[model samples]
Every structure is written in C-alpha cells, then in structure tokens.
Target: MTESATDTTPADQLGSGPGRVLVWFYGVFTVAAASRSIVQMIMDFGKAPLAYVLSAIAACVYGFITYSLVRGGEKARRAALVCCAAELLFVLVVGTWTLADASAFPDATVWSDYGMGYLFIPVVLPVLGMLWLRRAKR
Candidate 1:
C-alpha cells in the first residue's frame, strides 16, 4: 500500500494539524467579535461602553492568538498559551455574570450568557486553542 500527499494522519501529516483547526476557528471569531464590537462602539458606546470595550479586547485576543498559533514558533506558541488563559478567564467570568444579571449588560457582548449569541464558540474555542498550543510545544 502507498499514500499520496493528501493522506494526512498520524504520520507525514505535516505541521500542527490541530493548530490549523484552532487558527481557523480563532480567525472566524476574530472577525465576528471585532465586527460586533466595532459596530457596537460606533453605534452607541454610551449604551454599553464596558461591554463593548471587552468585546474589542476579546476580538484582539482572538486575532493575536490565532496569529501566534499559525506562527509555529517557540515564542508564538507561548504567546498563544497566555492568550488562551486570558480567554478562559474572560469566558467564565463574563458568562457567569451575564447569566446571573443580564440587566447589567444593557446590550449583548461576545461573552454574554456563555457566548450563547455566538453559539458558544467563545467557550469552546479557548479549550481547543490551548490544546493545540500544548501540542505545538516547540
């Protein structure tokens, strides 16, 4: 039996496979969260300034983390780990608070209600990102 270049698996699979998936997911969230934050900030910052700012921060984190993962280097991988930690904290705290006091939001943020509006990608993405970074351990 023989395998072609397309045969990606346990061997000859090339660089960080899981990292690829994480990067893709993070890239999507980067666009989604950044767009949402920008619109919210421009539309009515006075309505939910804090939430919007957090959204932007989250967006930036997602973008940087994605970049770090794709970078495939020691420093970049470590950077991704740090970003993943921050994301996990943000999701947990914001998710809990939003579920507890939706009124405090005044408007939806990416982490609100455990990212229900974003289909919980915020919750799941960090875990995958962390796992991928760990695997990439340069």
Candidate 2:
C-alpha cells in the first residue's frame, strides 16, 4: 500500500500546496495586464505609450512566472525566483517615477503608483512570490 518516491510526478510537486495560490494569482495578473495593455494600445497608444508598454512587459513577466510555477522543477523554480525579483524592482522604480513625475505617464501601468489601480497586488505579489519560491526551494 506504500507509494514509491519515483511515482511522484511534477504536477503533484507544482501547482499544489501553497504554490496553487501563487499560480492562480500569476495567471490572473497575466490575463489582466495583457488584455488591458492590448486594449489601451489599440484605443490610444498616443495617450500613454510608456505606460502601455510597461503593462505589456508586466503581462509577459506574469505569464512567465505563472508558467514556471506550473512547470514545477528546479529550473522553473529558479526562473520564477528571478522574475519575481525583477517584477518587484520594476514595480518600485515605476511607482516612484510615476509619483515623482505624474506627467510622464499620462496613464497608469500595472506597476504605477505601486499598483494602486490594481489594489496594490502588483506591488505585493512579487514579494509574496519570492518568499513562496524560497520556501518551495527547500
């Protein structure tokens, strides 16, 4: 009745436990940011090209992190960790820049104002992601 360690699969290892929530959040952000950026770009790229581009970049980062979390391996874990750090940095820099020079960004990006528009999920998610990733590593 005992199961062998070899019987465990990657799927069982990833997108399970606490990682399940992380994956879900990342997936949601990916879709939200991507769709928002696409719509903004189509409707009025001239209004806030920088913000829209940043939104697209954030979407890409979120998508990558979501995929890595789902993949569930050492490689994917490392990639997710790195991306989480980068995401945090982007949020901080963009947030500060937006605050200091509001005119620079006619519109807001996912990271602008530390994700105030998104209820600060974009600001907080990466910190939680990095912490979760570190815990998952062990």
Candidate 3:
C-alpha cells in the first residue's frame, strides 16, 4: 500500500513516544559502541580483535536502527524491525559465546554477558524496538 504525503499521525511515527525512547537508546548505544570499538581497534585491536569487531558491528546496527526510526515510514519501520532482530540474534550469540568460552573474548564487547556492563539494555532494547515498530505500523 502507498502512504500519502500527509500521513503524519503519532501512531504512524516510529520515533514517537516509546519509539522515541528506543531512538534515544539506540543513538546512545551507537555512540557508546562506536567510540569504544574505535578506540579499542585503534589502540589494541590485536589484543581482542573479535570483541572490538563485534562492538563495531553492533554500533553499525544501532546506528541503522536509530536512523530508520527517525526516518518514520513503513519502509523504515520494516528496516528497523529487521535490524532489531539481527541485533538480538547477535547479542544472544555473542553473549553465549562470551560466557561459554571466556578465552574467545579476552576483553568485553557491548553485548558481553548479555550487556552486563550496560545493564542488559542491549538485549532488551531490540525487543522493545521490534514491538514498537509493529505497533507503529502503517
């Protein structure tokens, strides 16, 4: 279905209310992961390449979701939903990997121990984003 130009209701806005909160969290996570990864990758990438790289990837995913939310369209909503799913999958895989084999990650990633450093927000945020996106559907 095609969306009209004047379709600017709050329900149609992915960045409204709770979606706005999602955007805030995603934006914060983007900055946090990006900066952490950039510094780690620059200073001591060889020390824990997997962790740093995973953090960088997480940053990219968070950045994309934040952008999709702010863009506020059906296409953007779908994109955000898909990214949230991927983010959750990454969190679970990485979280479990970090726990199952500590040697694999000498250092911690943003999703390490299921975002223990960040209060598990990394795992929870994506689920909330997906729900909000579904509700904001046009």
Candidate 4:
C-alpha cells in the first residue's frame, strides 16, 4: 500500500526534529529537579519544605512530558500538551509567589523567579512544548 499525505510515521508525529530537543531538555530538567529536591528533602526539609516539594512536583511534570514526547502518538501528544499547560501554570504561580514574598521560600525551587536559577528554562520550555505539540497534530 502507498502512504497518504496524512499518513505520518511515528517519528513525523512527535519525538522527532524539534520534539527530540524537547525530549532532551525535559529529560535533563527532570533529573535536575529531582536531584535538587531529593537532596534538599534529605538534608534540610524543614529549611524550605515548600521549595523542595515544588521542585519535586516540577520534576514529576518534566518526567511525564519527556515520557509523552518519547512515546510519540496522538494520545501521548495530548497528554504532553496538557502537562505542558499545567507546568506553565505552576511556574507562573510559583514564580510570582516567590517574588512577591521572599520569606515564603527560604530556598529556591526549580521554578523560583520564573526559573531564573535555571536560565528560565522552566518557564520557556512548556510554551515551546505546547507550540511543538500543536504543530505535531498537523
């Protein structure tokens, strides 16, 4: 059988081209956030419980987005899109909260100051992921 214009292979759908970069970034962020939170929780949980927990949550979101991108399917695409949106929301809220009240976070979460500590990747990645996922639907 011949392939139609819409008959994109798995690679063409997601986890290819820019999606590959997304996957790589997400994977790295996942590990980074997880490690930071794990170390903080073990070493000084009481010092900044909120910050550590937020970092852990960011790690989970990054992990899920990475998985969905690598999985490469319509379902996975949808899941990634939703997670990306949620991740963006969390970053905005947490970032704003951190800025508004310095005492609220004695330590920085992965998303502190709109991910300023990580060069703002935490804030930018989700927007990029959402755009890429939207294009992938085509």
Order of candidate numbers by TM-score, starting with the best: 3, 4, 2, 1
- By lDDT rank, best first, the candidates go 4, 3, 2, 1
Pull out the clashing pairs in model 4: none
Backbone clash numbers for all candidates listed: 0, 0, 0, 0
lDDT of 3 by residue, 59-117 (tens): 99999999999988778888899999999999999999999999999999999999999
Model 3 residue 21 lDDT score = 88
RMSD of 3: 2.6
Q: By lDDT, is 1 or 3 better?
A: 3
Error of 3 at 94 (Å): 0.4
Better of 1 and 4 by lDDT: 4
- Candidate 2 wrong stretches, greater than 4 Å: 1-12
Tens-place lDDT digits, model 1, residues 28-76: 8999989999999999999999899989999999999878766555667
Q: lDDT for every model?
A: 0.81, 0.91, 0.92, 0.94
TM-score of every prediction relative to native: 0.85, 0.91, 0.93, 0.92
Q: What residue pairs clash in candidate 1, if any at all?
A: none
lDDT minimum window of 10 residues, candidate 2: 5-14
